[model samples]
Target: MDIQVTKIGMVSCSGEELPEGTISRIACRKVLTDLKPNETVTICLPLFIAGGEEERKFAKKYPTITVDGCEKLCAAKSTEMFSGKPSKSLVVPDILKKHNLSAPKKLRHFGDEDQAAIQAVADEIAKSVKEVLEND
Candidate 1:
């Protein structure tokens, strides 16, 4: 017997140089690991861009949500360029502004102070995942 389960592909920004980028990655980790572990899968931006067959194929076959840490939108753009347009795209700074939260300054290590921003971003990513699933 073969059955298929619908899954949402999550792509997080690869911008490690910015604090927002770190926040984006952390948020995505939470969503993949804690928030939507069973419903979502991570589509790494670097590996996808490097032409990973599995990553590209999955993005092409399933709905995807992109989380961008900066205005450049590296994750979303790359996903669109390599596979197809993401069903939902989220920006970290915009998410913070929308939630009335402050971004953490630490680029490498996050403390309790960064929890709000991290949680907000993770929540948004989880929401996006749900949205894509519902639409599918």
Candidate 2:
């Protein structure tokens, strides 16, 4: 059976500036496309805290993948607290640490090193998602 997957990201303070090359988005798309046709994927951003009830309900019925930037792990924590399901959490800080990268101060000011780090994170997440979906 194919399981639905949800990709969630926490909000960054920088207005109008998204952290470039965050694998959260790319990994999300990869999982969605690779999953069976019956499966569905949704991207959730924490900027709007309101419509979470509906999201929580959906998550309960699906396999949610929560990607958190930095050490906050907001997406993963919120998924577990509100959705009541154990989410597959990808902590960006942990990935960055593997590559000896320092966390960026602002989302908008992502340098080449930051981009590379994000790409590595995204690639790993995509691999994990694919493995889970295929094995299910």
Question: Best lDDT goes to which candidate?
Answer: 1
- Per-residue lDDT tens digits for candidate 1, residues 42-75, read 8888889999989999988888899998889999
| Segments in model 1 whose C-alpha atoms lie over 4 Å from true places | 1-4
User: Candidate 2, clashing residue pairs?
Assistant: none
Give candidate 1's total backbone clashes.
0
Q: Model 2, residue 22: what's the lDDT?
A: 48
lDDT of 2 by residue, 37-104 (tens): 23445546553245655655666666666666545655666667676544467666676678776655
User: Which candidate gets the maximum TM-score versus the true structure?
Assistant: 1
Q: Could you tell me the lDDT of residue 9 within candidate 2? A: 25
| lDDT, candidate 1, at 129 | 79
Cα RMSD (Å) per model? 2.2, 5.4
